[model samples]
Target: MRRGARYRWVVLAVATFTQAASGFFVQGIGAMGIQLQRELGLSTAQLGLLVSAAQFVPLVGLLVAGELLDRCDERWVVGAGAGVVAVALGAGALVPGYAGLLAVLLVVGAGYSTVQPGGSKSVASWFHASQRGFAMGVRQAGLPLGAAFASAVLPLVAGAFGWRAALVTGGFVALLGAVAFMTLYRRPPGRAVLPRARTPRGVRMRLLREPAMVRTMLAGAGLISVQCGVGILTVLYLHEVAHAGAGAAALVLVATQGTGVLGRIALAAWSDRVGVGRQRAVVVCMVAVVAGMAVLLTPAGRSAAVACCAFLWLGFFGFGWYGPWVAQVTESAPPDRTGFALGLAMSVNQIAIVAVPPLLGLLKDLSGGFAPAWGLLIAMTLAALVASVRTGGARRSADPAPDRDEVACPS
Candidate 1:
């Protein structure tokens, strides 16, 4: 009977699957980017803008989706989101021009936003406080894991059947996963589940005034600056700078993503032991990111292997901060306000993602390479580190006892 209660594992698994599905669905764009540019006759700026369009829609979606997750059934809300993403991707595959592509990605991104907060809230509900970081790590790792899967497969699919065919294939896979999640995904059985609490209408204003939360959110956004810059440009950098073949560049993405999976899980789980708060851990991670960018600055030569190794290290730390940082955010949030806090944080993240890439890409365009652009990223990481230092020392809180009586074991 002790072992049988492990249905929580099933819940975690499906949630991971859904998050990973989103990754596979979006990562396809990056993998097929070069092909899409050629087929559509897009400039580098235009290509970056298309990728940004897919990323930008999630900001609005996240704001609204968080509210929905707080008030609605997870299964139904997520199921509907899944359907929207599937249809959006299917339409995206059929787009005849850049405008049509942007419109489709907007719809797809809205669908993408629903799964994240819903999955996160569900994980927080099912796990006890002590187990929260690992649970979140498992779920967060899905993003990179899914991206890795997509990066590996999508290029080949496009090579074989054209980019449109690859997009349609990805859409079909997402739709199938959505149907499965709707069918098999169950809330933990027999818990006396309470509706997620509501924040007052003025809570947004109140939260904006929160120095600690504000500092943390700003710090988090800064760290993600590196991720946004790297995600969009790393492939181009490899192709253009290192003169790597398409297969080789895709492998670099795989390496970057694969290490990030470990980094996300390992860093979060490490925070559980190291006795440092999430803020300091993030500062330390960003410092490593700065060093990774420095390594990239070195000339591409026999040392290129060293640069790849540096990227793996950088990738590990670059995207790894999210799990632990988000764990802290959720842990700090008032129970009723978890959804709002997370929503606002994601909104801030989306803004960084949307706002930063184009500026950095423009730097690349004007400078005729990425040296100046990467320098700007290093500056962003330094800014994040400063933000981390500005947040004062932590307050201690006792762990609450696990709610063993909350739910019966699933039979």
Candidate 2:
């Protein structure tokens, strides 16, 4: 019994660490962008395309990874995924030209997408329905935590040793994560431990057939837009508008990501207590993001300070929806289809990610500032609000989740 309890915590830790490590591959790119462009003599469009290549290819890989995750052993799925990501990070150290950078980042994106479904599936398998929100929240916190680590360290590292050294160092850390996951990660070892709805075949078809699932998937894309778009733009805004140092801009991402970690825990816990549906949490976050964008658009100095506060708030709420969203989908999915449902969510989300980056970049190119970028984001958020309301805005009030005691997973 003691050993079993120990392994449970181990599993949770592995999931969280795996998430953090995988995120670092591209999460540090925003910081790296300023340096890379100056060193490589690249244009905004070229830089945007390079980042977009890394950002977008994951969607294709995710479609496959998601399906494979549902059908395969969770251990092998996550382990292999992490291994590929580690390799991609190491390869990132060798990107000598834009083409090489683009190619390597594509691989990194593919590998990183593999981690999410595998991790989400593991959480769904290990925890009870009541405790899922908290479990998933803890797991999802990895995204921002890992990004924060990158934001905090990479700039200083690059400043001291050059970008190559920074990439190699972070690459080594990611590789170590792959090794750690392989060593420590495991799931309960029997068919009986599986969720009732999980099945290998025909699962994807079933998930898409649900109206609620379709709306949720679309809503998730909007949620991701808020996170990804803000993350991509924040550095440029800080640099160009506020004339802040790259190091400080990097640190702003760190602070924003740090606040996101808190937001993930708080909003996830709140969702369980308030019986608020994931859609509601997403809507509230969209509202916060719009406000953050407004503040970000204001002129420099004090406005930058105000925008910083808004960024922190946006990070908190904007990132908070992920845990509950995963829980809701996994728990409510038809028996024998959690893998498919989760995978579909991941894939659809990857598509959103692919679409957003370049679109924002293009808008910036056309408008000559981030005002157009923020305006576009506001439009996307508004669209998400409509989708959320149509799907289940009222569901939060309709379905009161079990109390906190009931929602806490057992160690």
Candidate 3:
């Protein structure tokens, strides 16, 4: 039992590392935007599409990944998917032109679609309800942690060896992560047995009709829009509007993602204290993100210090909110359905993720300022906050029992 207890933490560590490695390249795109723009002579909208391209396939791919996880071992599914990311990015290094890069990222996105849900399902299967929030938070933190690491280092890598070398570097990191997970990962005891039969589609579809599920899905859309906006535009806004240098702006983006890592763990730990009631924590994050965006709309956002603080605030609440939000999602699933629930809910979120960055970039281009873009995020977050509050009564009554089926490795 002592040895068994220790393995869960090992699972968490491996899941987190693989998740980070899988997303390393795409997460650094915003930091590389200016350089790519200079070299390729691309417009802001084009750069935004570059970010969106990686997210676009996930809309459908997540659902597929979720179904795959329910039937297969997460180890093979996740490791293979991440290996695809490494290969695609390595090939992308040799490909020239903006279109080729987009094509490469689309394949990368297809691969990454497995990592998030696969990692989440893997961690959720290992931890129980009482501590699941924190576990999920730590796992989710991998995305921002990877992004933050890449944001800081990739720019320097690109500066010295060119962008192609940076791509190759991401490929190498992902390859190492893939090999590690495949070698070390094992299914928890009892989960080694496969399901006797596949879950029916109708039963899975019923999740969409649940009031709590619908509310959580809506909230995720708004929150993800805010996340996408910040990830894609923070550096650009700092560089163009605040007159910060490229290095400084990218560093601020790094800070933004760094705070996100802290916020995910902090907020998730807070949710564990709050018990199974998780959406309230998400509401708090939504309100905080709205306030951060409001600050950015004011003249204070132009000051380098103020803008950095605002981005940190946004990063903390904006990106951090996923801990409780995802906890709520897993908790809300029907018996044996955590993977599908997470995938379905997050796949719905991919719509906003795919649309918001390019749309925000277009807004920036049209308004010639950041105000309108920030305002849109504020509006979306406010709507989410209100929806969450209105559905609080439902969430209170909607707590489902933990799923009995754990994700297992296939023999």
Best by lDDT: 3
- Every candidate's lDDT: 0.74, 0.72, 0.86
**Residue range 1-411, candidate 2, lDDT tens digits:** 446545666788888898888777577766666776777777655666665676676666766766576567777778787788778768777777667778877887777767887888776666656556777888899989888888878767776877777767766777777777778876654433332333445655756756667767776888888887767777777788777777777788889888888888777666666554555665677677777777766664236677677778778877777877777677556544566667677778877777777778788877888888777777887887787677663222222233311322334
Which has the better lDDT: candidate 1, or candidate 3?
3
The candidate that wins on TM-score is 3
31-148 in candidate 1: lDDT tens per residue? 6667777778866677667667777877888878777776776777777787788888888777877788778777777888787777787676667655667777788888888888
TM-score of each: 0.92, 0.89, 0.95
lDDT of 3 by residue, 1-411 (tens): 557667889999999999888889888988988887887888878888988899999999999888888878889999999999899999989898888989988998998888898889888877877678899899999989999999998888988888888889999888877887888877777765466355577867778878788889989999999999999899999998789999999999999999999999999889988744787688889989999999888888888889899999999999998888888888788646777888999999999988988889899888888889999999998987787778766734355553452222111
Cα error, candidate 2, residue 351 (Å): 1.6
| Candidate closer to the true structure by lDDT (higher is better), 1 or 2 | 1
RMSD to truth, every model: 2.6, 3.7, 2.5
Clashing residue pairs in candidate 3, if any?
A: none
lDDT of 3 at 104: 89
